[model samples]
Target: MLSEKMIEQLNEQIKYELFSGHYYISMAAYCASKDLEGFANFFIIQEQEERFHAMKFFHYINEQGGDVKIIGLDQPKTDFKSLEEVFDLAWRHEQFVTKRIHKLMDFAIEERDHATQSFLKWYIDEQVEEESTMLSLLRKIQLVGGKGHGILMLDGELAKRQFTPPAA
Candidate 1:
């Protein structure tokens, strides 16, 4: 069973995850509006991942015999001035989520909640990959300066991205 404090923290993280879904979907719409189909596809996949992340928390909380508290999320931005701005926001958001996951891991360790710690290990590794991917993409965007044929080439590459559901 999870402690009340642990449950509270986990619920907060769930809210954050849900908010990430909202944020990414809105970004996806913005990309679509700009006719950046590949970028739109990328953000849409990100949106789905965030939903999966939130559901993971929901299932875990219930499995732990905790009452899942559904929290409200703030509105997400729907407009972007440029592709660079969209990607910059993504980079910043991923960094923020990485910090939140690290904080949760620290709390789980302090509480000696081995089950929670073990569960969070998946998320820890996920966050590492998430940040790495975002940083690598940001670097590529920087190299291209969000202009000319380079952006189109990158878009073509991102267009092929499809979300493979996690293994059962």
Candidate 2:
């Protein structure tokens, strides 16, 4: 069973996860406007993954006998000066999310909630991969000079990215 505080925090995380999806879709739109179809495809896949993450929390909350509350999202940034800037922002965003997940894990440890800790372990692992992906992509963009042939090559690579839900 989850404490009321834990439930509330988890609900807040759900909102964050959903907002991540929204934010990525906004990024996708920006990429599309720039005629970066591959980049757009990448963000679209990212959006789908975020939604999947939100649903995981939604189901977990219910399984733990907590009421799941849907929260409103603020507008995501829709404008970007360059693809490198977008990836830089995305990498920073992932860092922020990693911190949030760590804080939640600390709370779980404090409460001696073994089940919650175990559940959060998956997220802790996921955050590592998330941050790494963003950083790697950002570095690639930087190395590629953020435009022309290099950017096109990266776009083609990202276009092949598909959202594959992790096995339950």
Candidate 3:
């Protein structure tokens, strides 16, 4: 069973993950409104992935015999000036999540919750991939200046992205 502090932190992370979904949902709307269907597809997939992450944490809490505390969802930014701004926001959000994950890992270490720490190793590895993908996409957006046919070409590229469900 998870200790009180560990349970609290895990619950908090669930909230963050849900908010992360909302963040992507908002970006998806912005992308759709801009007529960037491929970019929109990317964030729509990201939104699904974030909710999946939240559910993973939720199930982990239950699996660990802890009470799941469902919390309110905070608002996310609904507008952006350009595709570059959208990807920049995504990159920054991923960085923020990485920092939060580190803090949670540090707490789990301090508390000596071996099970929790072990579970969080997945998140640690996931964060690396998340940050890397966002940064790489952001750099590409910057390189192309997100204008004219460049973004359109990127749209075609991003359209090919598919969400591979994580292993059960």
For model 2, the local distance difference test gives 0.91
TM-score for candidate 3, please give it.
0.96
Report the C-alpha lDDT of model 2 over 1-168, residue by residue, as the tens digit: 999999999999998899888988988999999999999999999999899889999999999999999989999998788888898888888888889889989999999999989998998999899899989999999997888899999999999999899765
User: Sort by TM-score, best first: what order?
Assistant: 2, 3, 1
Best-performing candidate as measured by lDDT: 2
lDDT tens digits, residues 46-139, model 1?
8888889989999999999999989889999876888888878888998999899989999999999999999999988888877887778878
The residue-by-residue lDDT of candidate 3 on 1-168, one tens digit each, is 888988999999999999999999899899899888999999999988998999999999999899999899988998688888888888999999999999999998999888888998999999999999898988888888778888889899988888887774
**Which 10 consecutive positions of candidate 3 have the poorest summed lDDT?**
159-168
When superposed on Cα atoms, how far off is each prediction in RMSD?
A: 1.2, 0.7, 1.0
Candidate 2 stretches greater than 4 Å from native: none
Instruction: Write the candidate numbers in order of decreasing lDDT.
Output: 2, 3, 1
The candidate 2 region of ten consecutive residues with least summed lDDT is 159-168
